[model samples]
Target: MKGKILELLKKNKGDFVSGQKISEELNVSRTAIWKYMNQLKDEGYEIESVSRKGYRLILTPDVLTYDEIKDLLKTKRIGRDILYFNSIDSTNSKAKQLASDGKGEGTVIISEEQTKGRGRLGRNWVSPKGKGVWMSIIIRPDIQPIDASKITQVTAAAVSKSILELGIKNYIKWPNDIIINNKKVCGILTEMSGELNKINYIVIGIGINVNLDENEIPNDIKDIATSLKIESGKKVSRKQLVANIFNNFEELYEELLNKNEITHSIEICKENSAVLGKEIRVIFRNKEIRGKAVDLTDEGELLIENQEGKIQKIISGEVSIRGVNGYV
Candidate 1:
């Protein structure tokens, strides 16, 4: 009821919207509509009340309120059941516990600050209060465990598309890093819990450095990772960016769910990739393979061109990527 009323008010956009008309349209009593309007006012929605003209929505808070986000949502209900918190240890870790209690698919766990955030390769993710986006999605896709790499690729595609839609000239650096001007602005860490033969659930942790200033970044990482503010030369609203991501993610994920569209998605991913046909090196735990990044295959393996000019398909490991100049 609140969402419907809120939408009507927002659509009306501060013109006169009569309470009687809203009640008739929603088939509820005028008193109930008035109650809803008052409730919205209490929640920081600036609603002006006149004698008989009902109410007018004057302003909306910048916070990522459930109603505000849903109002802009045009996709399916992917982030419908959001578990938003002010602080947490990790969204992925929490989602795992939630899944154990039989939580349904598409349940999102988000936090304004993750005190003990993590990123790919167990690196500490810097999630300060109201500075970045720290969130995870709990999903239960009926797919084989061996095909799990596709999920990371799916996230990569969705992120790249979303970032580009924001009018940012960013592209992908394979496995999972959103690069802008050759610096990482976002990273993903995917974790799953289930048996090999039968799967249970998956949690994908996504962190985007949005509003951090250069001074906020640690000296060691100042040159490596960047935020939207640094790239765009001004502050970007976190609520707006997050809402766009969720909106695009819901539709793309549904397409993947219905048709298992990994093949086509992967093809598009390689096209926008930054490492293709370039000389590169993969540093694993034991050894480092220096070669040209010939191509990325359907199986999500990096085909490398060795110094001897031999083709080597290397499955992604707990390693690092580097351009011929230096570590990337």
Candidate 2:
């Protein structure tokens, strides 16, 4: 109801809208309209209510309040149910719990500050309070468990596209990352739950350093990670950024769900990837492979050419990337 009123006021920009007319249009009583108007006011919307004229909407805050993010998001379902937390251990953990409880699909957990955020390979992410975006998107795609890594590719495109839409120069690092000026701005991790043949749920975790101060960063990550605020000289609106990400994701993820084009999507991922043609040292559990990043196989495996001219394909495992600084 408040959203409809907002659209009406925004449509009439700078014009006064009467409460009676709004109520008639929305088929709600004048009291409900007044209540919703107060709700908008509490959400940092500048609305002027007068005796004669109904209400005049002024401005929208740039913060990541639920109300502010709801309208900006144009997705059909992915962001329709956003659970935001002021502080949490990990959105990924919460999203998993929600998925396990069968709350429903398309459930998303977003936090401006994650207290114990975990990154890929069990690393601790520098997700301080209100400094970055720590979000987990729960998806139950109709694909198998092994093919679930496709979500990483989907997120690569979504996150990279969102950053590009901001007009800042950046590129997608292969597998799961967005890098700018040779520093990591975003990291993605895709986890899944499934049986041998059937699939249950998947959680795609995304973390972006939106507007963190240099002082807030720990000494270890200061040199490798950078935020939009540090690069653009201003704090990027977390609400706007998160909305853009989900809005873009809705299009891509929906297409993937409809077609199940796992192979095609992985090919698209390789084309936009910056990991190829670089010298990288891959660290596995027991042995390591050092070779030139040659290409990705049809099954989303990394093909590395060793010094002996041997082509080794790695399908699944953690990759300790080295030799590429621009797109870490």
Candidate 3:
């Protein structure tokens, strides 16, 4: 009911709609309309209430509120059902819980900050309030468990495409990182729950540094992590960025889920690859292999040729590729 009222308020953005009219249109009492308007105000929406003229939306906060998102969202799915949080432990964890609770596919879990944020290899991710895009996308694709890893590739392509649309020259590092000027601006962690042959659900957690202050960055990774503001010298719109990501991701997801194809995403990753044709060190659980990255397989595996001229197709592992002869 409140969502319906907010939709009405947004529809009459700059102009005021009478409380009586709103009540009549929404089939609610005038007091109910007043209560809902006050609730929106408490949620950081600047609403103007006049004597004869009812509520008028003056401005919306910069937060990722549902009303703000519904205005810009264009995808048919992916973000239609969003679970927004000002702060949380992790969007991925929350997304998994919702998926388990039978939430529909394409539900998105987004947070302004994550107290227990994580990255690939179980490392801690620094997510400050209003600093980045911390969100997880819930997917229930029909592909088998073995091919589930390709979802990460799809997410990488989506994020890289979104950044490139902003006119930033970025590269997709193998497996789950986006690099610009040799520093990482984004990371993705793909997790899933499934049986041997069937996947129940997959959660792809994406974290992008957007406008974090340099001082807020952890000293341990300050030299290697960067934000869109730090690189572009301007504050990028988080709302637009998130919307763009969803649009791009939805296209690729439809291709993968409906067509059983990852060709487009694979092509994007290869075109913007940061490690291909470069020397790299692949870190596995037991051993490490050093080689030259030759190409990416159609399934998005990293193909590396060792010093002994032996080719290795790595389906999953941590890779350290030189940006300019050393770590970025």
Candidate 3 residue-wise lDDT, 1-328, digit = tens: 8888888888888999899888889899998888988888877789999999788989877777556777677789888888889899999989989999988889899998899999887888989998899999999998899998799999999999998888787999888999987689999999999999999999999999998777877887877888888888888888888888999999998999788889999999999999998989888887888889999988989999998999999998878876553644
Ten residues in a row with the worst lDDT in model 3? 319-328
What TM-score goes with each of the models? 0.82, 0.82, 0.93
With a 3 Å backbone cut-off (N, CA, C), the pairs that clash in candidate 3 are none
Best by lDDT: 3
- lDDT per model, in order? 0.78, 0.79, 0.88
Give the Å shift of residue 40 in candidate 3. Answer: 1.7
Error of 3 at 283 (Å): 0.7
Measured with C-alpha atoms, the lDDT of residue 94 in candidate 1 is: 93
C-alpha RMSD for every candidate:
3.6, 3.5, 2.0
Q: Show where candidate 3 strays beyond 4 Å.
A: 323-328
**TM-score of candidate 3 to 2 decimals:** 0.93
Question: Ten residues in a row with the worst lDDT in model 2?
Answer: 319-328
Global lDDT of model 3: 0.88
- How many pairs of residues collide in each model? 0, 0, 0
